[model samples]
Target: MVAVIKSSASIKNVLQYNENKLKQNVAQLIHSGNYGKDTEQLGFTDKIRTLEKLISLNERTKLNAVHISLNFDPSEKLDKETLQKIADTYMRSIGFGNQPYLVYQHHDAGHPHLHVVTTNIQRDGKRIKMQNIGRNQSEKARKEIEKEFKLVQAEAHHLKQAYEIKPVNIQKVQYGKSDTRRAITNVLDVILPTYKYASLPELNAVLKQYNIVADRGKEGSQLYNSKGLMYRILNDKGEKIGIPIKASQIYNKPTLKFLQQKFLQNQTEKQRHKLRIKNAIDFSFVKRPEQSLQELINALQKERIQLVLRQNDKGIIYGLTYIDHQTKCVFNGSDLGKPYSANQIQERCNQQMQRHEQKLTQRPAFKHANEQKQSALTTAEENGITFKIPGVKEVFKELIQTEQEGSLAAELRNDELRRKRRKKLHH
Candidate 1:
């Protein structure tokens, strides 16, 4: 089994995410730890009030909410009772057994998994220290639980792959075939906390890649003036389809105002990856000095860096965002440096394009000029006259269309073709 823990400032947001899953019928309340009522008996308000009461006890404890996912091998078909037992034991081992928490069996993946939502605040109003809890307590608990239950070990599991936190498989998300709002919400659940994008467009830059987008509508429109944001899914053609889900309706209420706060915070948090992105772009150019813009984009992609070039309807690029999948960071090109700005990168691409076009246009003309000269020399040679010009004669000597050279060339060509055919056959 594999375990992952995430801390959030709002238990409400954490609870809402899971409950929303339950409402969609894709998740279930398997076990409610330390709650007065059973998993099926407890209501949403009851669950929220019970956890928030302790959190309210400590005013300074902002990050009290904990979201933990326990993943099992896809081949392990554990029943509800077994899953409950394992979850309870894992919680007790990790010191969260006594806390008011909810365990949900999520059926959104290829494997069996449980999402536990709880608060770290103790009943006595003291906040439980969560720093390194995942690396320390959770790690210890996971290994023991695996051994105690005789389950498949994550390191040496039969599947040869460990289940971890992964973004939704966008390719499988078809509109009407799957739950639309739930799919979009699941995307937010992963992306909002994972990627550091400061603004709406920056956030959309990451979201759109997953076939989701956050829109504030046109300027001065009702939704825009009200500072409202809606997340909509895009089709294969990148057109918005189906109904749009309001940002307020999603987990954590990722409203325009909420994003403004993230913008300030991410502006600083995303700085640590600047040098990494710059080095990637610099190395791409150094690898091949004469590569075109598309080639440059492809090279960066090989390094897990995505260069997003945004253009207007007129086909003029207006913005650039570099998404580094390796670091899980996104940055507007202007934020990196002037050299990486849209205008400057466009300038570079334009120069490379011009050079490429020059090569294409000039090559055939040069070849044709040589062919004309060669033809004139061949005609003179066939008339029984020596074709000679001062410096030009020596330059054209090897290229002369002589009978002997033609037979020798044919033999060499036949030899090359034979070698190619033999190589193909051998392969």
Candidate 2:
């Protein structure tokens, strides 16, 4: 089983999240702790009043709400009773057994997961120390519960689902084709909690894969000034379409402020996965030494690592962001090191192309001799006996240039050179 623990200032938000899910019939209140009646039988007001009453004991603890989720492998066939017991045991192990927490069994995703909502404030007006709770207590409890229940271990479970990111097909959110709010929300529900991205661009690199983009509006705009955010669907051409969904309106409230916090948290989280990307890139090159830029992209994609190239209107690639699906990590090329940066990647591709080009152009003395003989054999009447013997090398060179100069790859190379020249002039 995998576990995620989060603390929030608004217990209502946490409660309402589950409440909304319950209303949608995607979740059910499974068990209650430290309550007189079963949690499933309690009304919304009763559940809120009971938890808030305890939170009011300590005004100093603004973030009193604790939300935890225990995720099981998709193959696991866990009944409600077993899930409740697992939640109960996991909570007790994490020192939340005495708290008036409620467990809700969620059936939204492909996996079997349970959401536990509770408070950290005690009846005596004392607040529980939540620092390192997830890394320390929750991890310990998750492993223990997995063993006790004979369930899939976290490491094993992740490995099992590593390369297979989304088992069920989730079509790209197209404007007007579906509910915009729900479509973006569904994408966020899967992305926000899973991928580790430090910045909006890095996050967007992953979001663009699902045809969704998080828009903070233009600089100096009202939304930008107010630090507001919106999620919008992108068309096949990558243009934004349809009405945008406010970040706050989303179920988990992935606001700009919220994402800023995540940016900090994910920076450290993303570091551990950098080596995986670096290795994958190096391996791709090793696998195909003569591969072009497009071939490299294909090789990386085959490994479930997306190599997103950021290019200008001129089609000059200026940036590279790698998305590792297996590890759920997004990393900029610069973050990986100088070798993986945009400049280096372009230089490498050009050099590889140059090498292959050289190999194809290089000719031994015998070939040159044969070309001279063939040139001599040409007769004026036969349409060969050149009026002025043209150099075979120059003839072939012009033909190669004619073939390459107008090619798409050559245009990209030209843009890259022009960009580099512009930078040089500016510097």
Candidate 3:
């Protein structure tokens, strides 16, 4: 579970995003802590009006907006009532019930999430005390909610799964320098409409026709690649333009056979290209001694390092190497070309050796620590103990066990759960 909070100065613009849809999905009135029944009777618009009225009534500062989102991983098979209870508990724990807060359950995304909007100013015309609250309060809320929900606590700096569209750098290509950027731009533009169901073979065929190649890997059963290239009959903005068709649905050729051949060919070509360039550079360097500096310059130029020459009044020359956008070291011409003194090289090698040893030492230590942590967590979970963040909620095995026991009510929780479970079972 993840909780994100955002503060706004205006409620009008914030709620205006999907006002109509939100209005239609207001589930139940859990609890309104400090505000009155009349205040509760006022709908969202009227609530905003009431807030304004309260501010005017007291001659206090105008009310600003406070928004919070609670995202939960419903993988634990929780029922609708339980889910709502959890959501309500989360809001209450975060100090929203005592304020003018409106909770909305959003069903637009793949996961079940809730959004809460409130005013910083209370009905008594006093602003909710919020200072240095960003980091501390958020962490506190997250910990409490996790414990209450009995969720598997995530690490402090856990690596989140993210979808990134990186440009593929192709060698021996005309736009080699800009190939990645150009490829990303072109692919995004061309394939944006038809990427959902494009099979590996069909994608490869289509890319081959346009001099592009589609790579494939697993995306939770559906195959995808780094490019996220898919074949869908969607319009430019991802709205359904027509029905989508898979490669197998459209083509008669064997998908696996063609992909195997193409993968082999691509790998072979890449290896050959790398070898050819290395050989050419080595041959050129061997043939030209006077142009050694030029060759070295050419070789290192590809790495984005800057080389500067310095000459004294006596005509003695020296070279400086700049790495990491800073001047690293200066060396004489001879030292720059040939290997350094035994002591100098030894020092450099020793530094590298120390780093290597440090890495070697830390790797196993980290691995052991992680293994121990996981083992402890597994044991605790089996013992029905809850693991959670420091300040957020703690989720006990009892909650999960109770949820699982209510499997009959799961069907009525949400249509999405049924669809997802069906898809998982089907695949």
Alpha carbon lDDT of each predicted model: 0.81, 0.81, 0.45
What TM-score would you give candidate 3 relative to the actual structure? Answer: 0.35
Clashing residue pairs in candidate 1 (N, C-alpha, C atoms within 3 angstroms) = none
Q: Over the stretch 89-179, how does candidate 2's per-residue lDDT look in tens digits? A: 9989999888898889998777888889999999899998986687799889988888899998878846456423341122433324556
lDDT of 2 at 315: 87
Give candidate 3's whole-model lDDT: 0.45
How far does residue 172 in candidate 3 sit from its true spot (Å)? 28
What is the TM-score (0 to 1) of candidate 1? 0.72
lDDT of 3 by residue, 2-103 (tens): 666654435664454335555666333333334455524756666566445543543443225565666666454555566557666765665556565555
lDDT by residue for model 1 (1-427), tens: 8887776777888898888788989999988888888778899889999998999999877567889889898878899999999999988988888898899999978888999999999989987887657778988998998898888887874544544333444455542566677778667766776678877888888888878888899999999999899988887667877778897776667678867876887888889999998998888767776677788799899989999989898988899999988777899999999999999877877876788667744654445555766786778679876645567666555555454345545665777899999999999
Output the lDDT of residue 131, model 2: 69
